[model samples]
Target: MRDQTDTGTTEPIPSRLLLGYARVSTDDQDLTNQRAELHEAGCTKIFSEKITGTRRDRPELARMLDHLRPGDIVTVTRLDRLARSTRDLLDIAEHIQSGGAGLRSLAEPWADTTTPAGRMVMTVFAGIAEFERSLIVERTRSGRVAAKARGVKFGPRPTL
Candidate 1:
C-alpha cells in the first residue's frame, strides 16, 4: 500500500503487516505459546512449523520469505527459532532485506533490523559469531595435528 504525503512527495509507507513465524524442533513440542505470542504482537498472519532448525530446508520459512513484500515485517519469538547459526541467520537477513522487509525477534530486541541501533547490534553479533567459528576451526586443526604427532590413526578402523 502506498501513502501520499502532503509535501507532494509519493513515499512508500511502511506496511503495518506483521508476519509471524514459529518453529518447534520435535513432534512432541507444540506451537501454542509461540502462536499466542505472535498474535499478541499484532501478527495478522502466522506460519507455524515443527522441524529441526539444523535442517537446511524449512518449507514454512521458505513460504513466509516468498510471501513477504516491501514494508512487511517478519517476527519470531526468538533468534534461535529463526535460524540455527550465525551464517544461516545472516543469509535469512539478506533475503529479508533484499525483499525490502525487516526481521525482529521478540526475545532479542537487538535483532530488530528495522531500527538503526538494532542493525548495529546485529552486525556486532555476526562478527562475534564469525570469530567464534574461526577459533573452533583453529582448535580442531590443532587437535588433529597433535593427534597425528602422537601416531593416532585417522579414518575408519580396519575390520578384524
Candidate 2:
C-alpha cells in the first residue's frame, strides 16, 4: 500500500534547470545545430524563432523570458542570437540580472552572467559592439557624401 501526504509534501522543483533560446534571422537559416547544442547543454525547455534580429519584439523570446524564474539559467548559441544591437543586449542583460536569473552563451562561454568574470566580459563586448555600429554609420555617411560629390544621383528616378 502507498501512503498519502498533504499537498505541500510534493518534491520542490529544480531551480537550476537550463532554458535554451534559439534564434535565426531568416527562414533559410536552420535551428538544428543550435537545438542540438542546447540539448546537449542540458536544456529542459527550448524556445525558437525565425525572424529578423532588427525587430525589437520577438514572441518566442518574450515567452522564454516570462517563463524564466529566479535561479533559472537562459542559454543561447551566441550573443547575437539574443539581440541585434548593443543597447538591446544590455537591456536583456539588465532584465535577467534584475530577475535574478542567469544568462549563458554556448559559443561564448565567457558570456555567462552567473559570475563576476562573465559580467566583465559582457561589458567589454557591449562596448565593442557599440564601436562597430558607430564605424558602420560613419562609413555610410562618408560614402553618401562621396557619391553626392560625384553627381551620382541617388533614390528612385522620377516618372515622365
Candidate 3:
C-alpha cells in the first residue's frame, strides 16, 4: 500500500514511520505550538528540547539522529528549528540521507529531500552557497592585499 504524507501531494511516500523534531532556544520558550504543529503534520513521535541552536552539541538532536532507521521520515516545523545555518542543515540532511532517511520542512516546501526535484534543489543550493563563499573569500583577500599595498597595517595597534 502507498502511504500518503502530510504534504497532501500524494507523491508516493516510501517511509514506514514519521518522526518530528521541535526545539526552542531557552527554558522560557514553550514547545507547545511546535509540538501541535508537528502532530498536525502526522508525526507519530516527536523529539523536542529547549536549547540554543548555536551550539552544535545538542543532545536531543543527536539522539534523534541516532534513532533514525531506514525508510524513516523526519519532519520539522521549520528548518531553523533543526539547524543553526544552511551548512549545518545540509550536513544534518546529508547524514539523514546517508542513513536512508528523508527530511521534510513544513515551512520550506522546497527543502524536502523526499523527491528528486527537492534533492536537486538542495544540491544546487549547496554548490551555489559554496561558490558564493569562495567569491567572498577571494574578494576579502584581494581587499586585504590592496590595503597592505597602501601600507595599512593589520593586527594590534602596538603598545601605548
Candidate 4:
C-alpha cells in the first residue's frame, strides 16, 4: 500500500504501523486497559471486539487482517484474547504472515513473530502443537476401536 501525494507523486507508506487488536469474550467486559496498553505501545490504530475467541468469524479481527500491509504489526493484549486454541492461533498467525505482517502479544513475548528469536520460538511451538494434535487424533481412533470391540455404540440415540 503506497501513499499518494497531491502532486501526483507516490511514496512508500509510513515506515511501519503498530496496529493493535483488543478482544473480550463478552460485551460486558472492558477494553479500557487493553486500549491504553496499545496506545502506550505506540499503536496508531486499534481494532476492538467483544466476542468469544472460540468463534472463527470475528468482524473486527477480519477487518484488521484485511487492513494489514507490509511492515505492519498486529498487537494483542494477550494470546488467549486472540485465539482459543493453538491451532487457531497458528491459523491466524499464518494469515498475518501471508499478508506480510507480524503478530505480537503484549503479555506473551514468546509469541511475537517480528524478531528472529521470536519467530523461531513460534515455529517450534507450531511443530509441537501439530504433533500434539496428531497424537490426540490417534488416541481417539484407538479408543473408538476398542470401544466398538466391546460392543459399545456411538452416535445419537434412536428416535421413536
For residues 66-138, could you state the per-residue lDDT of candidate 1 as single tens digits?
A: 9999979999999899999888998899799889888999998889999999888878877888899899999
Q: Give the per-residue Cα lDDT of candidate 3 at 149.
A: 100
Tens digits of lDDT, candidate 4, 13-114: 756799999999888899999999999999999999899888889999999999999889999889998888988889899999988899999999988899
Top model by TM-score, which number? 4
Model 1: worst 10 consecutive residues (lDDT sum) = 8-17
Q: Give residue 59's lDDT in candidate 1 (0 to 100).
A: 98
How well does model 1 score by local distance difference test? 0.92
Clashes of each: 0, 0, 0, 0
Q: Which of candidates 1 and 3 reaches a greater TM-score?
A: 1
Ranked candidates (lDDT, high to low) = 1, 3, 4, 2
Against the reference, the lDDT scores of all candidates come to: 0.92, 0.88, 0.92, 0.91
Flag regions of model 4 displaced more than 4 Å: 1-14, 155-160
Give the per-residue lDDT digits (tens) of candidate 3, residues 29-88.
999999999999999999999999999899989999999998899999999999998778
Residue pairs with clashing backbones, model 3: none
Candidate no. 1 TM-score: 0.82
Candidate 2 structure quality by residue, lDDT tens digits, 1-160: 2334576465555467699999999999999999999999999999999999999889999999898888899999998998887778888987987888999998888889999999898789778878988999999999999999999999899988
Task: Give the 10-residue window scoring lowest on summed lDDT in candidate 4.
Answer: 7-16
Error of 3 at 3 (Å): 12
